[model samples]
Target: RQHNLRIKVARIFNTYGPRMHPNDGRVVSNFVVQALKGEAITLYGEGNQTRSFCYVDDLVEAFLRFMATGDEVTGPINLGNPGEFTIRELAEKVVALTGSKSKIEFRPLPQDDPRQRQPNIAKAREILGWEPTIALDYGLKKTIAYFDGLLRAGDGDLARLAAQ
Candidate 1:
């Protein structure tokens, strides 16, 4: 309540959808681009690390709802889908969706990699009455389609993105 500042901090999670840069280095983009390009799907660590994937549409809805809240609701709430999946699982899904011959490549785990990333959305559910509706497979299918178009049109730094 210091300074009575009006703030609604929503901790966004791994959001993926259309219009994402292929080489943004984000997990979703990395996998989708790699899969579509028939490149190795890089999975850091044993691919056991978990992450929650949220569709952009759901995140936007949460943002709108959070902003419309009363001033008293100055929440540092987590806004993301609670569904969690391992890195390997995500890569596999991308390959399957894209039907690419990309093999799963294991990379050295970054020292700062977290073992888990599923959000505790109880507060978001109770306060903002919001939760993600788009499932990972559905979202990935859409994302894969987008990246496929970009790659087919040669619209990005393919050499640079694949290097990541």
Candidate 2:
């Protein structure tokens, strides 16, 4: 963690739509991939943990704005959707989007897992005039479509493995 040159915005709690691995450890990716593959969705802990999801495009835009900001703007701005969601809620959304009959399952909660997390994006809005425009439902739908196409194309195997 070198603190030398100018570093502008610091984006925290970034989640996105597509290109997420099918079996990656990330909750969104794991849930989507599991539903697509007809596997049970596993949530660590009580599934009450909350997180902020930011669309990929919005993240890029935030970075652009940060870079463009005058030198006066030196920040560790949280570039993420202020909207929060519980783990279970997200899993349910994934199932609905994929149209998968997968079941939700839970395992032991990981140690040090925060039960609640949502970014405070006030700085981003006030400083960069940036905000996440994509709604969660819309983003999930797009991500599901991508997963569906992969499954239909017989690329499910690759996608599933990569996701894992």
lDDT of 2 by residue, 1-164 (tens): 29667767585685776776665577777787789889999988879889888877788888898899987788888888999999899999999888899999889998899888788989999999998999998988887877676677775694554454
Colliding pairs, model 1: none
On lDDT, the candidate that comes out on top is: 1
Model 1, range 54-136, lDDT digits (tens) per residue? 99989999999999999988779998888989999998888888899999989899999999998899999999888889988
Query: Considering every candidate listed, which one attains the maximal TM-score?
Result: 1
lDDT score, candidate 1 = 0.87
Candidate 2: stretches off by over 4 Å: 1-4, 159-164
lDDT of 2: 0.82
Q: Rate the local accuracy (lDDT) of all candidates.
A: 0.87, 0.82
